[model samples]
Target: LESILANLSAGVLVFDRRFVLRTVNEGALTILADDFSGLLGEAPENWPRQLALGEAIRGAFAEHESSEWQEQIELEHTDGLPQILLLRGTQLPAGSHGGYVVVFDDVTRLIAAQRSAAWGEVARRLAHEIKNPLTPIQLSAERLQMKLADRVSGSDAEMLSRSTQTIIRQVEAMKRMVNDFSDYARLPAPELTAVDLNALISEVLGLYETSRATIALKLAAKLPPVCGDATQLRQIIHNLLRNAEDAQESVDSPSIEIRTRLADNLAEMIVTDHGPGFPPEIMARVLEPYVTTKARGTGLGLAIVKKIVDEHQGRIRINNRQPAGGGVVSIALPLASLPTRGHRVSQLPTEA
Candidate 1:
């Protein structure tokens, strides 16, 4: 049992009465980029990973009388692989030989999630507080220009009017940028209706039908109604379809296929295209606001898609298409048990 537990994939350490290393698990050794035999007797200074682990063990020893010692700690190993360890255990009963058991867990992913969530909150605040004020400023500028036009006449007045108009125009542009950021920040609780998923797809498809890219809607026959915000949901689709259309720009035969299907409990919308695919490294951060790949791109399209999907309690995943068409984006939205939308998806005119 001792060997079995030690061999498990958890960084573990046992310390004797003096807090000296008595045993280290295979997991702990692996994290240190070494085997247990090599690390059994070495002090922390000799191993970077074990230094953090060793400190955690000591902290556990000091609080031995407590019910449990649990802390999430970060460690950097000589091998360059950073590992997160969860130090957790209780003190052995007072005996001739006292010791402690500690467990190390890799929480790198959890920490990343926490960081993403924190930064997302900061972005939201910046958008709302900073972006919200620009709209009023723009309106005020517009009103001031109107007054200036009426109050005076001449080249000087014309200059003032032009200046005011420029201010208004720039402010209006900034407002749109702010709106994009605000969209990235503020989340709307979806008012899910029994939306004909196919109908919504068609409406968005028809809206973009004028684009040079050949867009097709492959709706699942007898598709179930989806629960989502009709307007924002359309925004999500529009953004994706537009992205696909943009991707298809350099393709020999530009084409985008909006395919829907059931994958377990979620409704999947896959937008596949034929163009140069997304760069692998940028792919992960592609959904983040303002992370565009174009020569002059705002990069908010996918970010807005991500935000809306999140509001609708859906997932948006991106991947390259099979057999090399281009990129394939999958949006899996939770199937609503009860009606989550108050609006419905109505087909729009293809010409619009």
Candidate 2:
């Protein structure tokens, strides 16, 4: 019985009707980062203050009948970040000795994933609504200018031309923005194939050879292939390169470094650049759609990259490099040799 309770996935704790700790499983000790000996026979109010479970437990005992409640608790011991836990408390049946049982599970990652999916649905609906009218508006402006140019003369004709040009340009800009939203919202399943990472990176970089920025490549030899879609991978490379270029606009000398290597069971690709790093304020929410610092940016580039990476069952991290000044974007993908299912899977359209 003890061994079984020790291995349970969820943390379990039982307290007496008076709010004294009756029993705690090994799972609870591990989840709460506390010792079993310290919790036994102690009142909930006297439990370790750091755990912060005192108030919730006491309230449950105060109730006249069985009740249920849920809350999230953050623990600094796990890491420097908040770890979200889904806690459910149930009042045990009334009897000669009544108690309460509490169960909790770590659900931080699950909540984040759900939020991302919600954003993608929103992007798809927004694109559908905004993109439909842009083409007609642009064409109408073009036709109005061409047909009426000879009909009007002098300042009137000049004014008409400028107005139409502004309209066309603005409409074209809107089209680009809507297209980006569509891409983020409606990404198709990746067509999985064994792709040589080094070769793919070299090919993508070749497209920017004539640019003024200084670019460097450090391709590791004998690197393993990864399973992913070549087209989507190319887009990811392009977006990262373009972002690096834009980030360096305020700097005197711009340089970008693309590197590939094998790490443990994963194939890694890293893009680093000497430029103004991501602003501290938006760093946490960088992958969120429509969150941007650039004056003209649609802010969907990184979000789209994240969507594609998720489709491939890969991971990505972005952070400012230490000591030296710059930013790093690193991606880790499972090697092709690993046993994995094809990435081709459908996502049902989420309603707006």
Candidate 3:
């Protein structure tokens, strides 16, 4: 019984009729981050802040009736993001001392997956509905400008020309927006191949070396390769760099730094910029689709980067840099072993 309970995937805890914690499995310890031994004789009344759990157990023992309940609990740690747990409680059968058993599992990833799937479906429908009419509208406006420019005179023609130009420009902008939607909605599966992240970052940085922002690099010399789609990874890098550039546009000493290192069996890349940090109101939901603070953005840049990172089985975190006025974006990808010889790799990024 002890061996089986220790190996169980779901956390389990049992309370006596007196509401004292009688037993707990290893899963409980892992899930709740509590020492099971210490909780053996502890009463639920003293279980700080566990209002729902205490209420369910007390009701079951008081009414002598089996009860079932479910609730979400947040687990915060010092190293990573807070986890969300789905907890279920059930009243056990009557005995000399009746008790209730609780089982819980971490459902954070499940919720995120559902959200991602929903967004992908929405993106698909939006791109299909919005993109089809843009080209025709643009073409019509251009044709009108060419055919009617001389037909009108004075301010009429000037207004006509301006109107056509605005239509053309707006249509082009809409086309870009639709393209971004398509990219996020139809993100292809990453073609796994051994990729040197440092080299990849260097190649991406080469494209923006001429920009105003001072781009700096601090790549780990002995970093391991990561198995991922190079094309998608490049796009991720492009999005972050562009975001940093946009942020630094208004700063006096605009600067951006790209750094890489290995931590906890993962290859990590961090992008930091000297600019105003993310607004407090939107920082938590910055990755959600259609959430943006920029005037010209579709708000899907970070969302798409998140999608690609998720596809690569990686993690990303966005937070304000400490000591204060800049933003940091960090991503960690599982390191991959070098591929064997004769292994076929995919085409160049352009083809992808």
- Clash totals, every prediction: 6, 0, 0
Question: Per-residue lDDT tens digits of candidate 2, residues 21-77?
Answer: 887887777766667566688887676644456665566446535678777764544
Candidate 2 ranges beyond 4 A from true positions = 1-5, 13-66, 72-82, 91-100, 142-162, 210-216, 251-255, 274-277, 322-325, 339-352
Give the whole-model CA lDDT for all candidates, comma-separated: 0.71, 0.79, 0.81
Candidate topping TM-score = 3
Error of 1 at 170 (Å): 1.3
Candidate 1 residues 224-287, lDDT tens each? Answer: 6666778888888888887887887777889888899877657889988888777765764676
| Per-residue C-alpha lDDT of model 3 across residues 190-252, encoded as one tens digit per residue | 888878999999999889968899999999998988878899999999999999999888898
Model 1 TM-score?
A: 0.61
Instruction: Locate the minimum summed-lDDT window of 10 residues in model 3.
Output: 343-352
